[model samples]
Target: MARGPVGQITRGTTGTNRLRRVDRWIARHPALRRAADPLVVDLGYGASGVTALELHARLARARPDVEVLGLEIDPERVSRARAQLELVRAGGASFAPDARVSFARGGFEVPVPGGRRPAVIRAFNVLRQYDEAEVPDAWSTMAARLSPDGLLVEGTCDEIGRIATWVAVGTDAAPRTLTVSLRLAGLQHPSIAAERLPKALIHHNVPGERVHAFLGALDSEWERAASVSPFGPVHRWRTALSALVDAGWPVRERSRWRLGEVTVPWEAVAPG
Candidate 1:
């Protein structure tokens, strides 16, 4: 069989906790917990495999038997990751077999060794370099490799992961939800999230776009709730999100908002 296209290598400047929000989200995903075949793939996990290792450690909390594989197109990057794993193991690190969080040389073709289909594929910051037109096909190709009930989480985030957004996609490659996660301590306006939206919504942030209106409403509410800023940043966010719901924005939950995140059904923000 012919190997798939080996895309351009990313800058690969990864760091610890740079993908924590997505990791936390994946760990709590129902599919990850209940998968009879709990295999997750971290596609294009940059120069360092720290994110993959961290993902394994966190997701294991929900499914201790889960297997996490990090795939990269760069062979040298894979070798370096293997060396890091060895050092971690020699230091009495707690991780599954070397197989649990192993690195593989592959591209979006998602060549899982032994042809294993993944239950969850976290491809953060992987498609930022590709044209937005390529996103849908890429999503389709990856979701096709799911083990029945799989999820393809594709999105981007700032370097430190404080401002992040992702689209949760089902096995059929249909987007189900849009989640915006941030570090709310210094939040100026929800529009700041516009800078971090996934590929689909990034270019749609203009008049006549649902995402644009959603963000506009959020910014308006944030200002209207400025009176509560004295109470605290969290209080202000809660007030703004409350206004969003009151304004029929269909915001997700207060609990999630309190954690510097809010998820909306994809229908609410899907392109017109």
Candidate 2:
């Protein structure tokens, strides 16, 4: 193995607010809210440092002491983000002047000072370029750098923030839940999230597969819930989620349904 970062460099596509959905989910996660060390890692945070800044702003609302460390394997990208961080520190950016954010060159090995472990690691869109067979090892490598009660969030989303899906992995390196979040208004169907499924489950979205079955069920319930559309997309979304629960799907986090998001136990949609 090479003596450096454990992963390959990928497309640096990034935009403002592109990760709001996942950031919202992480902000509310117990892993950050209750951790002894409220340190968060924004691994592979693309071309700009804005996502890391946004993550800290969002997480700080819940855990005032939350610190975000943005990691990238590419040295130039790291330098560029550090420049952005300086602007923020100088109060030239929209974020807080002293936002607890930093940039470093690292990958799945998740290097930090003095063997410190992170409370949550958000590795969004970083694994899309890797072979599906490589996901477990990648996840295990990152998860090993987490605190005992920490979480590793891995997922993908569209260019805009509308549709997103992520898996919450525990320090044990086992995926616990899969969450699908979308912009309900004007959405044709809930299953559009299939296009953005995380690398771990994207290819498994096929006929006779667990994910295929789950999205199929979601689309069906979405169509069936159309009668309540007049009440607005949020209500319609809540209806579909309620029906999914009724239909025996192990859906969780009912409070988030109104936001056009639903989470299910990983086993419910893991490839079979």
Best by lDDT: 2
Question: TM-score of each candidate?
Answer: 0.94, 0.98
For residue 242, give model 1's deviation from the true position in Å: 1.4
**Which residue ranges in model 2 land beyond 4 Å of their true spot?**
none
Candidate 2 lDDT over residue span 209-240, tens digit each: 99999999999999999999999999998998
lDDT at residue 15 of model 1 (Cα atoms): 80
Cα lDDT for residue 119, candidate 2: 98
Give residue 236's error in model 1 in angstroms: 1.7
Clashes of each: 0, 0
Global lDDT of each candidate: 0.86, 0.94
Q: List the residue pairs that clash in candidate 2.
A: none
Local lDDT at 27 for model 2: 90
